[model samples]
Target: MDRVLADDLHALHSLVSGLRRDIHAVTAAFSTSWSSGQVEGHVTRVKLLKRMGFGRANLDLLRRRVLRSP
Candidate 1:
């Protein structure tokens, strides 16, 4: 990381810096088996459906769409 940061010509400098800033979280993610991937996927799916439906979808329609989605 230091080597990459030290090299002015390196394209990875910015990425390395970001990784350094969030090193603890990055390491924890690698070390831990627990994750919110399923919850996040559900949230993303719901948000996409809401966006697609926009002002036309009612609560029941949205509920049905969400329930029916894979």
Candidate 2:
């Protein structure tokens, strides 16, 4: 009975290990080149521009201002 239980546990572990490897393969294929670091940097710049403008600008103007300034 003990040997049978051990064999079952070993089979479960192997199945879980294979699933983990497959998940990793899928994730690697779907990973992005643009990371959170770059995104956060752009967000920080946008906030600074927004604050400096004193909340009076329209979206088109703001977009032009942000894009043209740099």
CA lDDT of every candidate = 0.92, 0.73
Q: For all candidates, what are the clash counts?
A: 0, 0
lDDT of 2 by residue, 19-66 (tens): 666987657657956457887988899988888777687788878878
lDDT tens readout by residue for model 1, 1-70: 8888778857898899899999999999999999999999999999999899999989899999999999
Model 1 scores what on Cα lDDT?
0.92
TM value for model 1: 0.60
- Candidate 2 — worst ten consecutive residues by lDDT sum? 1-10
TM-score per candidate, in order? 0.60, 0.42
Number of the top TM-score candidate: 1
- State residue 19's C-alpha deviation in candidate 2, in Å: 21
